[model samples]
Target: MSGELLLVGSIPLDTPEDVFRTFGEPLGKYLFAMPDGEVGPRRHWISRVHYQVLAAHPELEVVQRPAPDENGVERQQPRNAADAWWFKVRDGIDRVRFGDPGWRLGYARDAVNSYFVFRTMKEKGVLPSHLRFQVSIPMVNSVLPPRIFPNRKDIDKVRPGYEAATRAEIAKIVEKIPASELAIQWDCSTELQDAYGAIAGYPLEGAIERNLIEVRNLSPHVPREVALGYHFCFGTLGGWPRFAPDDLGQAVKLANAFVAASGRPVDWIHIPVLDRSDDLFYAPLRELQPQGARVYLGAVHNMPRFEKRLATARKYLPDFGLGAYCGFGREPTSELPNILNDHLRAAQIAAL
Candidate 1:
């Protein structure tokens, strides 16, 4: 009996149709829900979309552009400081108000569009009838990151509007898609980074509490019938992991906070696992209080250490789903097959 499998949103496939045929068709049996692969612009994660949203705000101005890379090419919307275009409140503007005229975050639009394909594929039997269409959305802090906003005051000014926009997006999604056919996973990278103190100038004090407040705010927007999950991430913007923590202590603590703060029942939680196989690293998981939500450990990568990591993780969490540390969107398209294979193989190993 294989354990459950979770796909962390982005897939490297070119289109929703391809993702459905490729990932959904094969992995459908192992998965409770599936994403549209977050193709095209979303393949780079939320950065590209966020850049567009922030750049369009009338009160925001580009204060600094990313320096050119070694290849002498400067990315217009880089994910990190090294490649990101920094923004600030425009001169004479005391407050930054996003979505003033109306902000289009695009998650709802994309999810609704992709859902059509998902429904079509299921009808055609290319996907399992039981699989819900998963929409992976970035948390507010992730979209308006400290790296891009820099100033905590600017973040404060922009948060309400962005959050309102997010809630509206969720409203549209729930209205268009049936609750039973949908699952929403809030991706948390910046929040975790702040909690870990990895992001410079981002205060660690009360970081977990702040993140919990976000969970409380957004999780309620997702109707109780629509499956809700949280993806605790370290980010793969600049690399596989923008920051590697000493252990799972902070991640577990943060996960616990999110679960407790969520106003509604959480269907699942995805916690990324580093490549460490040591007991000390996995021990923190023992303290994870998941309530009634299913837990998925992202211990699929770093194959050579897979067994050790799984064995250690099992000692603390005897029953949990398996997933990659992050999405496959940033990986080379050529690696998709192997990545899929790895998930399947990891499931088999977990069953043993």
Candidate 2:
């Protein structure tokens, strides 16, 4: 039987100036069953790495562009998750791939995800108290252009421009999408410490420091009902950082982690446990308890078949509404669907 579509609560929205104007309003969204209004200027920034990589490896186009980054120029890349497209690269000398203004899935997907929610509400004439979404992986700073902390006069304005642009983009989402429909899940990928420091030569402490600051800024703009959750894990980026990542145990001990108000401790953690056929991190994961929130030990890893997936989920998190995790496998093109399916299956099993 063909499986039904499962909702993935998280997706990146394509930001343009017009979209920013709608923050906290009902009628600003061009997509999503929003407050309502006229369509705003559509701005889809080109995915630089996707085009370049797609051109170089047409076969992997299905996977997505494995973006390029300067060893230390600035910006961050999307590591592990099913859809972290490469946004920029450092070392301006390379001309290895092409980028395009088209290929806009975020815009399309934003509309699609929003329509699902909005349409349902329309039919029933009911609106949800809050619109929940996974905010973009706020962890990757290396992929972005350097936003020198102090703002240097000699440096190119790329960082500041992107920073303003990003704010405006979020602002747009804020103005248009009602505060009632917003909750954020900050995916800090497991590798908040060592991996990033080693790979991009970014200071782990500084990176974590920066991330928390961003979160603090984002929190004020969000509604009180908007649940703010963090997904922490040791991430694998660029397909170069080897797979088989682990819990951010080493990193968690650092000050970067803040205990939530509830009492559990160890920073907000989410580790990929079930991969291929093994629940590698299950036993070790039990020790993780972040005070304010709960950590979901990844019950199913490496996307599983329908039967095994269900059996395994029941085995791990039978009483929770947590997500499933199957670490990246093979390549992005082929694996994302399987990963997505695992997410769908998890959602289905949860409902049952």
Candidate 3:
């Protein structure tokens, strides 16, 4: 069977028009959905918006600033500590309450604006009419990560307000876009990191449960008619493959938990595949129970590794879509064509 393609969000293009012309135009046939490349500030993912939100909060303070490297140059923000800022609950503030942080997250506004370009492209016959305009939103914990908050207590205190704001963002997006033409993907990088015991100063105990709680809370906000999906990410904040587990056991367990906890029908689930193809690594996929949701494996990075990974994955999954481990927004613009080519090649291989 010819497997479908999943663009895990951001396409690294300059504009929605550019993304529709360059990415959606050529790959629309293979793609079930595509994003506007998360152009402008969103190219940095949640950090750009999160920083603005956190910075404006009275109870929070920027405690750490990017330190100069050995070369005396500050690194780019959000990629690593070089260009990032850390926040903490103000010393005098006994409790942190972001009561209506009084700003928009920019997701809903961007999605509505980009959808215009998406629809235009489709009308021009540049993109397939069946393609849904994907809108990827980070889980609250992902946006306010332990790395940024550095305090679990502070995150607990701040999460409710942030989550409420996130839900509102979803509400706005759904209100404006037709459910059938929209797909909402909740990016779960930080949750997966915590589940893997990868986050510092955070206990791994109940991490999966915590993630499920958040999933249950956020999933219902997405209208039943709107396609809902979860992108189970290991993260790419500092670098790719943030957590290289010996096997897919933990990921599979987490995926199962997410599917079970989500109140509505999850249209799809995306799990990142490592570069290695060891049977031991992909073995836990045998335990996956998607519950009717389409499964997409992130197995399109290295062609050679992809072939081997796909072979191993097929032993258990049998059938699934293909995608990169995460979005291409962080990559240089020059590399997008190659990334697009990789997806095309993987699709061809999957068909074979």
Number of the predicted model whose TM-score against the real structure is largest:
1
Poorest stretch of ten by lDDT in candidate 3: 94-103
**Candidate 2 global lDDT:** 0.36
lDDT of 1 by residue, 169-221 (tens): 88989999999999999998888888898878757888888777667788877
**TM-score, every prediction:** 0.95, 0.48, 0.93
Error in Å for residue 218 of model 3: 0.9
lDDT tens string, model 2, 1-352? 1111111122122231212222212221211212211122111112232333222432222323333455744322333333354232333423222223212212323433454445355444343323333233232232232322122221232333333333444555555555455434444443344434543444665654444544444434444543444544444444423345444344344223433321222222444433433344333333344554444444434444534544553454343334434123223434444554555555555456
Q: Sorted on TM-score, highest at the top, how do the candidates line up?
A: 1, 3, 2
**Model 1, C-alpha of 212: deviation from truth (Å):** 2.1
Instruction: Estimate, for each residue in 1-352, the C-alpha lDDT of model 3 and write its tens digit.
Output: 3228888888777789998888787778988788888888788787776566777778888877666677988543554734577888877666555444223677888899999989888899998888888999888888888777667578777787777778888888888899999999998888888888887777889889978878888898788899889898877767887678788888889999998998889889999988988899898899999999899999989786678888889998898998899998778899988998998898899989
Model 3, residue 176: distance off in Å is: 0.8
| lDDT score, candidate 3 | 0.82
What C-alpha lDDT values do all the predictions have?
0.85, 0.36, 0.82
Q: Higher lDDT: candidate 2 or 3?
A: 3
Off by over 4 Å in 2: 1-161, 189-197, 203-207, 233-243, 246-248, 251-270, 274-299, 303-320, 324-352
CA shift of 62, model 1, Å: 1.1
Clashes of each: 0, 46, 0
